[model samples]
Structures are given as structure tokens and as C-alpha cells.
Target: MKLLDPYSLVLMASMMCGVMSAVLFLVRRSFPADIQGLGHWCAALAVQVLATACYSFKGTLPDGFVLPVANLLFVLGNGLCAIGLQAFYGRAQGWRMLGGALGFALVGMVYWLFVVPSYTARVTWMALPLTVINGTQLWLVLRHGRRHFATYFLAMLVGVNALLVAVRGALALVMPAPTVDLTQPGALQGAYLVITAMVPILLSVGFIMVATKRLQFTLERRSASDPLTGALNRRGFDAAYTRELARLRRRPRTLALLAIDLDHFKAVNDAHGHGVGDKVLVRTASLVGAALRESDYLARFGGEEFIVLLPDTDIELAATVAQRIQAALRTACDSGIPVCTASIGIAAQTDPRQRLDDLLEEADQALYRAKANGRDRIELAEQEKRRASA
Candidate 1:
């Protein structure tokens, strides 16, 4: 009994799971939403603990209650973890598949316990469904989880447990010498006890790692964005612009920048209140963002100003996009706002060696000219005036 202390390890693992669940709850609140799938992960932990508790009373409890019920809970826990993995990847999962698997597990358990009389048969029956669930989880990680270290670690952990389960089932079904009981304290039984007790907590840890990794990524992205309009802030935009310049040097493509300023934005704030002004800002960003190509990048450049980077774009397309933004804002302002419009300044990189700051300064000059030209228009930076064009 002391040597085969599955109960102690199972209980300790359950306690660890409880601690992690509480930790995840706190960690989850810090993220944007329930993107971590912490709820399902925590529920899986609790379900696994409950399943183990049910199994701990194997002989003390009735076979019908202990065998089918405990196994069903175990399957449910695994299903939830699988769903959690899908959720973490921002993928949609078919709950019907899990429901069918769960139903099969229950039906198999009923048939094995009531119609069959052999312990070996019961072992193989439970093994098949459990292996299927584990294999499904492994497939998910292999398919969609290449970007993160957590995926690899989790796949390895689950793979080992799954192999152990398959081997255990094979041994129970085909071993020539029959054991007196599953708890007979032989090598096979000892290995089985250790695996069954240890795997739940280990799998829980893997779930926590993946969820935490994803949350970290989301937090990093939000940190680089304007919280109000979900546009890249000045710091984030600068980083991206620098990277694009490096790429442009190697690839030698025409990169265009559009510096946009909202016309009479201060008056909109003064007359209509800052709240409406904020709404206009959000609406402007949204409308202009929609008018650009997927490859084009938009970023908030502080106070009713924005920068759009159009990689591989010439001045013609850049001016067209600026005009589209102007038209979009014209209609938006006419309908929702009394008097709101935009003035855009365009600059194209003629020389690949042009610095980002210089490019921006030329665009700023054009922007200033647009403002000086009675606003609500577009101005192009004079390329001939620059020390080097573009």
C-alpha cells in the first residue's frame, strides 16, 4: 500500500492544479479578454482532479459507478483541454466531435462493465478512447502550434503519456502470464499507477504555459497600439517605418508616405465636446484604414494626425488613397459631423538612401503647405527641392 501510493501523488497533483487555476484567474484579468482560454483550462484541471478522486475508490465504490463515471469525467477533461488549445490558437472547434467521443466513452464503459466480465477487457476499452482523445490533442498541436515553444513542450509531454497508455493497454490484453489484480504491485501495475497519477498535473502545466505565452503576445501588441482606435502609436509606427526602410534598401521599391491632419479638429472639440471629437478621430481612423490596401500600414501620430505607409506604392496610388480618404471623410462629416475634413501631404522616396526623418520632414512641409492653402486639400512634397529625391 505504501509503495503503490497513487492516492498521495494524485492528491498532491490536484492541489498543484488548484494553485495554478487561481493563478490563471488572476493572469486572465490582465489580458484584453478571455483569449487565454483560462476558463476551460482551469475547468479541465478541476475535472481531472475529480476523475482521479473517483478512481481512488476503485474497489470501495461500485464498479458501475466508479468505472464508467470516473472514465467519463477523464474524457470530458481531455475534451475541454483540446477545446482550450483550439481557442488559444484563435481557431474554431467542432464540439460535436468531442460530444460523440464522450458519448462513445460512456457507452463503451456501460457495455464493458455490464455485459463483459473481464478486467482485461475493461482496461482495453478505456485505453482505446483515451488514446483517441490524446491523439486528437497531439494532432492539433502539430498542425497549428509551430510558432511557440509551449506547443513543442506540450506535444512531447502528451506524446509520452499517450505512448505509455498504448503500451499499458497492449500489456493488459496480450501478456501471457496473468496478474492476480491490476493492483498486484508488479512492474506493469507500478508503471501504470505512476503514469495515471502524474500525467494530469503535467498536462495542466503545459496548458498554463501555452495560455500564458499567448497572453504575453497579446499584451505586447496592445502596448504598441493606441488603446482608443487600435492603431499603432508613434513609437510603434517609428519601429515599423524603420524596418520598412531597411527592406526597401534591399528590395529597391517606391515607398510612399501620407501625412494626414484633421481640418479644424480643435474647433470640433471646443464646439462639440472632446467626447465627440474622440468619436470623429476613431471614425476617421476607421474609414481611412478601410480605404487602404491590406499591405498599407496606418498609425496614429499624436492629436488628429496619422501616417500611412504604402510599401511598393508610387505617388499616383498614394495620392489616390489620400483623395479617397478625403472623400470618405467628406461624406462622414456631412452625415454625422457638421464640419470635419482632412488635409493630406504625400511624399515618395525617389532615392533608396533617403533617411526616414528626412522623408517625414518633406511630408511635414507638404502637410504644412496643405494647411496654409486653406486646408481640405492634398499637397505633394516638391521632390526637386530635396538634397536627394524620395
Candidate 2:
């Protein structure tokens, strides 16, 4: 446990950080949709680890071999952090902007390493660019991460690290010249070295938390939605239908259900194949969505059948929606692989005492009638019979 000195300590810490970042990178790849730009975050940490390793070689290696590469990767690593966080918030870092900054850092490193070869000059050059990258990250988190505490902590870490770099750069201008040798104790040198050695682990932890949360959210959403058309799946539909029924009980409002079936969908699959039929299902969902309003719900009830809930809608309005959806499907398939149409059966209930199963059964019966009357038509449930019974 002699891991106390600046050089040895940094070497160990950087190695561990590199491993953690690499592992997290692999995990993020498993859910690429949820954690966008995580690959960049992983790359940044890996580069930072290498840069720290180069610092360990300070006097042992030639400046030409170590200085420029280390500083270049250091700056690039910080830049990638900014880029990755920007992606998390749906903001993108333009390549032109990134390339320009990266190029400038490289040019500066070459000038200092070859021409001046001063440690102070290299520190000043590396510090300023790192500050800008960190500052940009601070702005992104503040602007978009207000709701997430993980993001707030991330911003704070970046902010402090940026300030430390700025302070080190300023001290280099005033303090006497210091060599890359770690044996001699200098205040600014020891402080910044310790920080660079340590911050990556904390930063990695914070970013991983952010990524984990995003992955969880995405998984939850996927569970609720159909993979093909993005409509609510049967399980999700049942939950929603239950909620709508509860609402009807709390208040005296009309609730309508539309039981919809795709006409000749089996034939579409048989003639055009399942691939084309899937496209038709997706298109059918889109068309149904277009016909519905904000207070409506659409679910893939089962194969080739869908259920729609129209809140505060009566039989007439529901019938109109059903007709519009049928027409929309007909038009949508006019030029596609095969002609497609829909049969919709609607049922409405204004009484708070009515049961959900009763409503669904009425709608299903009406759907049967529409099929009996020939496909691609709308049918309404027998409200009069229920009214007479009540």
C-alpha cells in the first residue's frame, strides 16, 4: 500500500480508471439507443489514462516522444467528455468545431515541445484548452441537466477541475520554472498532479450513473410499446384501459372504445409475405394515430387487431373517428404492396357504474357485426338495449 507518492499514485489510479471506463463502454454498447455518445466518453477516459502514463515517463523519456502525445491526448480526452455530455442532452458537437480545436492544441503542443521545450510552456498550453472544454461541459449541464442531480454533480466536478487547471496555468506564469521531475515539492505542481491523478475515477462514476438511469428509462419504455409500430402492447393496453375505467367512475363522462381489425391482413401476409405485412401494420398504426386526438389511446390488442380509447367521446364522434381511420388506411395502402382497409366497432358508456369487460364485450360484438356486414366498415354498439335495461 505504498501508493502515496504523486507519480506512483497517478500511475495506479489512471490504470484503474482506464479499466473502469473500458468496462462501462462495453456496457453502454449493449444499450446504444439509451446512452448516446457513451463510446466517446469511454474513449476520453482511455486517452486520459494514456496521457497520465506519459506523465509518469517525464524525465525517463525524451520530450519529443512524450510531451506532445500526452498533452494532445489530454486535451482530446477532455474535449471528448464535452462532446459525450452534449449528446446526452440531445445537443451535438459539430466536427468542424471539434477538429479546429483539436488541430490548434496539436499545433501548440508541437511548438512548445520542439521549440521552447519548457514544462511551464507545455502546462500553460494544455491547461487553457482543458479549461475551455470543461467550461463547455459546465454550460451544457447547467442548461439541460437541471432536473437530474447526477448531472448537477457531473457539472460541479467538471467546474472544479476546470478552475484547478486555470489556477495551475496562472501559477505557471508567476512561479519559478519547474522541471517534470516529481522528487522536488512545488505547491502548484503537486496540487494539479494530484488532481489529474484522482478526478477521473469520480468523473467516471458520475457518468456511469447517468448512463444507467437512461438505460433503465429506455427499457421501461420498450416494455410498454410494440417493437414494430411503437403502439402500446397488450399489457400496456390493459393497464391504460383500467385507468380509463377508473376515470369514468370518478366523473360522469362518456368513454368510447373502438375495436379495430385489419381487413384481409392474413391475405396480405400470404400474398406479399410477413415483411410487407409488418410494414402495413406499422403504416396502419400511423394512420390510426393521425385520425385520433390527444385524449385518445391506441394499442396493439393482438395480432391484426387494435384497440382505441376515446375519452369524452359519444357514439357519433367515435363513429366518425372509426370512419376516418378506415378511409385513412384505404388511402395509405392505395400504392403499397396491397390494398388495406379497417373495420372499427365503437361502444360508449356514460354511466359510472358500467364495467370495463361489459364495454369491451359490446365493442367486440359490434366488430363482429361490421365483419358480417362485409369488411372495411364502422359499427356502433347497441346503447339503446343497455339504456332500456338501466
TM-score list, all predictions: 0.79, 0.75
For model 2, residues 225-244, the per-residue Cα lDDT tens digits are: 89999999978777877788
Point out where model 1 deviates above 4 Å.
1-34, 90-100, 118-146, 158-198, 330-340, 350-353, 384-390
Off by over 4 Å in 2: 1-5, 25-38, 82-96, 111-128, 135-196, 242-255, 290-296, 310-324, 333-336, 348-354, 372-375, 384-390
Best by TM-score: 1
Per-residue alpha-carbon lDDT of candidate 1 for residues 1-390, written as tens digits (9 for 90 to 100)? 456554565677667766766766676676666575667777877787788789888889897899788888888887887787777776887478778878887887788778866677767777787788788778887887756788798898889878876776777788642552445656656666666666766777787777677767778778889988888898888888878888887887889999999999999999989888888888988999999998888999789999999998888888889999999988874355555798989998857678888998989999999999999989998882352354
In Å, residue 163's CA in model 2 sits off its true spot by: 5.3
The lDDT for every candidate, in the order shown, is: 0.79, 0.79
Model 1: residue 93 alpha-carbon error in angstroms: 7.0
Model 2 pairs in collision: none
Per-residue lDDT value at 343 in model 2: 84
Estimate candidate 1's alpha-carbon lDDT, on a 0 to 1 scale.
Answer: 0.79
